[model samples]
Target: MDMEQSRQKRSFAPRALPHEEYFAPGHRGCQGCGPALAFRHILKALGPNTVVAEATGCGEIISSPYPQSSWRVPWIHTAFENTAATAAGIEVAYKVLMRKGRIPEERINVVAMAGDGGTGDIGLQALSGALERGHDFIYVCYDNEAYMNTGMQRSGLTPFGAFTTTSPAGKVSKGQSTWKKDVPAIAAAHHIPYVATACISYMSDLYRKILRAAEARGPAYLHVLAPCPTGWRYPSEKTIEIGRMAVRSGVFNLYEIVDGKKRLTVKVRERLPVSEYIKAQGRFRHLTDEDIAYIQRRVYEEYEALLAEAAQI
Candidate 1:
């Protein structure tokens, strides 16, 4: 094969196919909801021996209505701000149950699932405590960049220029003027065993991270970039495509922090301009050329900084 063809083939790694579906279909998730896909990947990776603790968010709401649930495994519903605490309790209880001979000693992974609102904003304390206490569980944050389940309100993880109901763009101000909070960095700060960022477009990258989190973990964290159609003001069918663009445009850099080392998982050798990503969504419509240029510069700077930091380690 030609060098160019080989390099092109290397751009995307083939998906590591899953064996079983822990999340059954026929739920209320909007078409192309990225978190729904993330949940499926997480379930596919964790398997039947997993216990999920979910916060009151889109995933729990859409997947589990009164008399029905999408989860095939044991699932516990927790408050929006207490999923990590609930998962920590489950971990401790599982140990106690094992000691009493009620359950096998083999580990049954407990995963705390939440949205960006629950993770970076309300549930930060619970997550911090769980990680600091060394809970043997994975905390999954399916961040759509807003409080989408509630009312598309802004959250701490929202990017600098994204529009939301609360942080709406106007003549006086741009939407969400602050930087996106680095949740994985916060998890890494706790000196956890594993911390990673994953997106739906890269299923294999996400699956490996999920499996690794489930298989071997001490306060592992997976921050997933879930694109929301309603909140993001994009077509439902473009979810996966937009996710791919986000990564390719360097809006979201996929990486993992393991044992104090940072590694970039997927690299777009020649990144697409950030405009190619923002132009598709109405959320960024208010951004002027100067605004976009500023954001583009910031994005590339951060991407380069990440590369330099990874290289040093």
Candidate 2:
């Protein structure tokens, strides 16, 4: 990036918009695709000297086509299940190359990017291995909540009571049966140095987490809550609003786990009802009043549990 571009990226003023453009405009992503915005902020924090390993998902689909590309940095294309493994190899190769005097001492940040389906389901084993081996890299999972690229299929990260092609709400059944997988908590269990949750609407928070992950020595995991307009059945314009509602409703808590402490960054002391959040999306439109009440209880229970965990920290 140029000097002016650099200044724009580093600008942290809450009101002033970021001038630097890392992901670049014009891509195959649908209107109001949440991952598109998340990728933009991620590249801003990592800067130019970064090696990326993106899995076979929306991030790879929309950005890096065979003949053309969207990424301005050195990026490698990897399979859905081995994105973390590929990134680990790259990180090792970089360090070895540096020691052998083949490369400069300037640190080259390594990041593995994947969608929730890749990271939480097919890619889980490879991700666990990379973290367990203590690779110096950051793994970013942009969670659109389901397998959006192919069809609106339910994945491990898909929330309960949400309608999907695979989990359609029928006369005898509700939507998705299981709760969303707690990927961040799973990452924390690996004893990683840094793990955080970010939403696409909150650009500043997302940028901060990316930088934190980049600076960490060992494996770092950043789970981003990127809303899917097409899959979630919401209007394109309400993408940012839905994201904010997720956080404010305490449904998608924006918290960071650092130095063994879990602190809620965006505090919702008197959180809005889960109904307010569910009613905004078409995926949850089939939910009944009783279903909404159950969801609200689950949300409150999870938030309280997080508070208890934070207290111990």
In candidate 1, stretches whose alpha carbon ends up further than 4 angstroms from where it belongs are 1-16
| Model 2 ranges off by over 4 Å | 1-11, 14-18
lDDT of 1 by residue, 5-24 (tens): 32234222344344568888
Clashing pairs in model 2, backbone N/Cα/C closer than 3 A: none
Best TM-score among the predictions, by candidate number: 2
How many angstroms is residue 49 displaced in model 2 relative to the true structure, after the best TM-score fit?
Answer: 1.0
Superposed Cα deviation of residue 264, candidate 2 (Å): 1.1
TM-score computed on alpha carbons, candidate 1: 0.94
True-structure RMSD for candidate 2? 2.6
Each candidate structure's count of clashing pairs? 0, 0
Candidate 2, residue 106: how far the Cα is off, in Å: 1.2
